[model samples]
Target: MIKYLGRDDNGIRKVVLNLFLTGDKFTTGEVYDFLDKGNFEVSYRGVSAMVGLMNTRLGILSINVTGDHNVYSLKESYKNIVGSVLENY
Candidate 1:
């Protein structure tokens, strides 16, 4: 967790925004896998926990759960962040 948010919230949000900027469909588990491949060393369970926090506490991300898993996407203005850092955003 970075001291800015003091709760790892910003880091989690950044991860989500980065994935969404990839402009590809990703399931929760797949997203976890994608992030886990990175240098940050976070786990699938950790990603799941952050997703829950984003959904319930921050309300920055919206989700749709169907069949076997849930898909997560963000709300507005968060696009600003995605646009600044992403390639295809």
Candidate 2:
């Protein structure tokens, strides 16, 4: 998880790529499990902080908190962004 993101120069970029490549948005706990199982470098707090930051960095969708559960999803516009990356890649 972190390895893929770590390649990007920006923390937010690293995080967004992780989200993109994983192909789905995930809850914090789910992401926590993934990182732990994968033995990634990010901490739970670190993932939470990065989710919040993506809202500002992407200038689009933001994480929504529900019943004390925080859910992260890509903004609608991200398809356009992903298309560009896919084409370039």
Candidate 3:
């Protein structure tokens, strides 16, 4: 957790946003793989934890944990907002 004045929520949100930018549903391992390949230093444990927080607490993602590998996708409400921003950029 990267902290600024004793809080790391911003850092966690950034991680979730980056995952959202991938534009595809991804597993926790897949997220770690993507970050690793990009040379971004992040722990798999941290990613897994943050993904869960985003799904359950922040409501930024939807997760299906019933499969062999859990899959995560951006929530529909966020998708439309992100889609519009991406289109303009």
Which structure among the candidates has the greatest TM-score?
Answer: 3
Q: How close is candidate 3 to the true structure, as a TM-score?
A: 0.67
TM-score of each: 0.63, 0.62, 0.67
lDDT of 3: 0.68
Candidate 2 displacement at residue 1 in angstroms: 18
TM-score computed on alpha carbons, candidate 1: 0.63
Query: For residue 11, what is the lDDT in candidate 2?
Result: 45
In candidate 3 the C-alpha lDDT for residue 42 amounts to: 80
Higher-scoring candidate on TM-score, 1 or 2? 1
Residue-wise C-alpha lDDT for candidate 1, range 1-89, written one tens digit per residue? 12223444436556665676555545668878777676567778877887777667756566788888888776565656546644332
Question: In candidate 1, residue 35 scores what lDDT?
Answer: 74
Per-residue lDDT tens digits for candidate 3, residues 2-79, read 221125533444545656865679898988887678667789998888678767866767888765889999877787
Number of the top-ranking candidate, with lDDT as the measure? 3
On the 0 to 100 scale, the lDDT of residue 65 in model 1 is: 84
Which 10-residue span in candidate 1 carries the lowest summed lDDT?
1-10
